[model samples]
Target: MNLKATLEQWRMFKAVVEAGGFNQAAEQVHKSQSSIHHAVQKLESALGLTLFFNEGRRVTLTEAGELMYRRACYLLDEAHKVESVANSLKSGVETYLRIAVDIIFPPEMLYKALNKVSQDYPLLRIELMETVLNGANTLLKEGEVDLGISPFPLNSGFSEDLCEIDFIAVAHPSHPLHALNRVLTLEDLKGHRQIVVRDSSTERKAESGWLGADQRWTVSHVRTSIDIIRQGLGFAWLPLAIIRNELETGVLKPLPLEQGGLRKALLFLCFADGDRLGPAARAFLGELRYQTMSLPSVESIAE
Candidate 1:
């Protein structure tokens, strides 16, 4: 059978539906209207069906044409999938990598890496999705994400530990909680306001993490929560890496809690144990591992 002719007629049919007329489709597809008409006529003849009901200049698809149009879309979609697979094979790399991560890594880091890698490996592509511990792990289990950077322990047995980060709480310079040289207690934080990250689905929400917490406000992003705290709005819990400068400049002061600061490990997750990392992913992970180790410890909270 002449598959090429059938495919050409299928595409022309789609074009005509999209353009709303044969003349417009001809202009868009760079084909004469007569050529398009001839192809469709041949297609109908070969298939033993009526495709169009011609009335003067306006053309409408017959019942058979409408049914064929639907199937044609699926056929074209499959063709594009084939093309994508061929390109991926020719490029000698995987087609896609979907990574879901905790909101820890800033977009700047990923954007910078993309810019650098795209120069050398044009086919390399990375997509970033943000989720908390539960959501991130779910995507990894469902095979939605090629990887996930999570804080949750991987019971799925398909993950590896990336690195651990210390969580620290900080208060504004003028807040009452900062005036106490003694370690901050729940009672000490009771009267004061606090800014906290409220994990939610639709929007990043903020609420007090401490109840016996406080009357403080909540914010979604660490940057904004830290900003408000620096302005003396309230105290907040955040990674020390995010607030290093403010600590040094005396804009924000540590709460001096007697208990050790919260310690959370950042983990890398994949679908199977001993999964081999891709080259681009490996490079990024190498730099991240080095950077994570070099981070200043909580001892620098006084700085």
Candidate 2:
């Protein structure tokens, strides 16, 4: 028996299985109904198996047909990936991209953007570094990263205002601050310990959002500060994105400050050189920008 199977034959079989009939499959594959039917016949003949059973004009897959269909789907997917990788390489997409993101930025937003890039450029390598405050800026200045998302603008790079992150002063529900029962003032917070995240930069060590509380505990990362606050160790102003679940579950409660419990930090996305960015870096930036636009604007929420 002579056996010959082609990619086109497998594609026709898949389309027929998915579209429910040869006529519909022909419409999808841009082939005539007879051609689609003939391709499946040849495919079944090549494998020496009955792939489908016909009942009048309707058709259904046999057990062997279902198995072949599953294998054909895998083969087609792998073929598409091979073509995609070839095109990416020909287009000069970078093999490796390093991005420094501010720790205060929402993790979900970052992951969503990175996930999209991975789908488009599967061959690209990504290095993600989470930094605090000016740490991203430092990385960009040192030429250690291709892109940087910082809360503050860098001195020598192309930058754009990405989005504003809302920070809320919060404490554990069982903390003494919540027991005050009234709108607490700055003076009232001075006696309690404040959990502050130290700036990650080795040179500057800049600090922000300190309320001059007499007692303080400094931590390196925002996550650490949040964990400490959740334990009722101290109160800290944290990004609302990181603590939404805690706020909903009554684990953490926003402190009612006289001035306002929330503050907005403007974030910027900077490139070492916009003109020099490779295709992978540019595509990643585009995805990041698109996802940032979907986030809630500062005006949408009460200050």
Candidate 3:
């Protein structure tokens, strides 16, 4: 089984589509325009299908080329991942580890786990993606991060019960809602502003619960939402871990909702490529599991 086209040729073909034309693609790949053209031509000949057509002063994908371009993109991405795996293997104990941890996962716990892992690999470089909602899962699916701690249940990949986060509806003690001095209903919040956090996933944006209120304020970070609520600007359901200080200090008070005052989500440890677990990734995983050994989980939430 001899493949006529090479990964280099496919990369140049993808470059042309992404860069908008061969001239730009040439500049991007740091190669001559003729070389870029030759590579695309070779790819077309090998595949026996025209991938692009020259129109007036612009180059565009042919009907068949559109499909091939998509296929080529997948091929190139997988090839890049293969190289990444190889690099990890060649250099034992990966020098860099990309991690995505949902903000709800207790920042203090996360920092402790990271510190524990760093003790063994002092030179490890870590890229921490503090995501909200579906953000961690998005990065894992896109191969952007090696591992993640997410609240969303995984559709694929290896996952284990990490911990449970309690979300409570709270507002500033001075807010108008507390003036009622009685149990509140969903309808009671209709006229008040609800501070909501934006889902971090650009690929698959989703909503968890919508409290149909007259006013809504969407913020990117939980800290921002909490800050707003602390000022009596609005009310929000914030993670107990993050707002514990505020709640204890009486800066934020719980809203007496009719029911479901406490919302609990079980977070999971996610591994993008669990099959090829690198030493650095495995170390982080172990540290996380070790730290969460006594934390509350689904069973505790039920009780």
* Per-prediction CA RMSD (Å): 8.8, 16.9, 3.4
The lDDT of each candidate is 0.67, 0.86, 0.84
Model 1, span 59-154: residue lDDT tens: 788898889888988798667656755665566656456777666544444455556656555776778777754556667655566667766655
**Model 3 Cα lDDT, one tens digit per residue, 1-303:** 998899999899989998889998988999999999999999999889998889754589999989988998889877876887788788887788899998777777788989988998899999999998889998988878889888876787788888878888899999999999999988898889998877899877755444878999888888888889988999888887777777767899989999877788889888756645688778888888787765543244334
Predicted model with the maximum TM-score: 3
Location of the lowest summed lDDT over 10 successive residues in candidate 1: 200-209
C-alpha-based local distance difference test score of model 1: 0.67
lDDT, candidate 2, equals: 0.86
- What TM value does model 2 have? 0.68
lDDT head-to-head 1 vs 3, winner: 3
What's the TM-score of every candidate structure? 0.58, 0.68, 0.82
